[model samples]
Target: MEKLEQEMPLDPFEHIIFDYFPVYVEADVEAFLDLTSDQEKKKCTLEIVHAGMKRAAQAFNWDLQILEKVYHTIKQTGYKSIFALLKKSSPNKKYVCSIMCHHEVKRMDVYVEIKKRSGIVVKKEKLFSVKNTDEQDLLSEYGTLTWTLNHKVEFADKDYKKVYRLTFLEKDKPEDLVWKMERYEL
Candidate 1:
């Protein structure tokens, strides 16, 4: 726990923006929806989402202000889906590998690009787009987004250096923004 604390400092508002990692990655939302009636499916899904959010907030001991913002964001933007990027380094830190969750929206997709470098030269690159919105254009009823062009990863672990960055791009202008970077132990 001490080393964990020293390495990857937890972000409290993570649960709000993204679904629970690993578990959500393997979750079958459609299968779960099939278990309920048409009228109850949406309701049940919302309930499950709310419950998960509440539980995550509790687990992290986040402040009320953060929770409130999360609630309002979900209320406005609607929790469409999450994009998870799992990046890991090879032994000796010479190489890196990345795995991103695949999500699809109706209209347009969000593009993601990652550049991993060992020194001055770029070592590897990973790029993809996940569709999770139906907006005709960038602007929509929900809100605008915050574009984070770069996030530096300074620390590396023993076995395989791993880090994750989650960015949210909304349609309308959102005042308070949430971006997350996390490291997982292997």
Candidate 2:
């Protein structure tokens, strides 16, 4: 059996703002709500989220004073950056991570093992920066990357969980932000 490591006490503010990983928590909450479609299930999910925040507080042993700093860190750093730093320090694990605009750019360094392939030859190349937030900016950044594909691969992963999909369609050579999101749920 393994014992948990001793946690250092955090200031008061840190305790309050724990578990502010909003996106994942929102997904989990949505999943719970869709599972049973009942009020009891909704209440249970809310309780679960509440308990998770409390557990995070207890794990860090934080108090009220540290909450502001904790919130700032969460707002600025995000959960992925910490994970990205750890991933970067490790050797040859076949993963790459970086920050892009307000999102995380996580890619598998291991040549994505395509079960099926795409034949569309993208004879283009583009340079991108982290500060570019506009959709047009992203398109322009990736506008020059020329990738040549020779196989028609099924885009969807054949996994049990519902997989959401998005395909970016560019109308002009400069490329526009007019991409569309299609989903199984929709």
* Candidate 1 clashing pairs, residues 3+ apart or interchain: 104-131, 105-131, 143-171, 143-172, 144-171, 144-172, 144-173
Listed per model in order, the count of residue pairs whose N, CA or C atoms clash below 3 Å is: 7, 26
The lowest-lDDT stretch of 10 consecutive residues in candidate 2 is: 82-91
Per-residue lDDT tens digits for candidate 2, residues 25-109, read 2235455545553444534444454444554555567673465565455545533222111111112222221212323332211
What are the lDDT figures for the candidates, one per model?
A: 0.39, 0.32
Model 2 misplaced regions, further than 4 Å: 1-28, 31-51, 55-61, 77-186
Model 1 score (lDDT): 0.39
Please report the candidate that would top TM-score against the real structure: 1
lDDT of 1 at 92: 37
Candidates in order, TM-scores: namely: 0.26, 0.19
Q: RMSD to native for every prediction?
A: 18.1, 16.5
Question: C-alpha displacement of 133 in model 2, angstroms?
Answer: 23
Reference-based lDDT, residue 150, model 1: 38
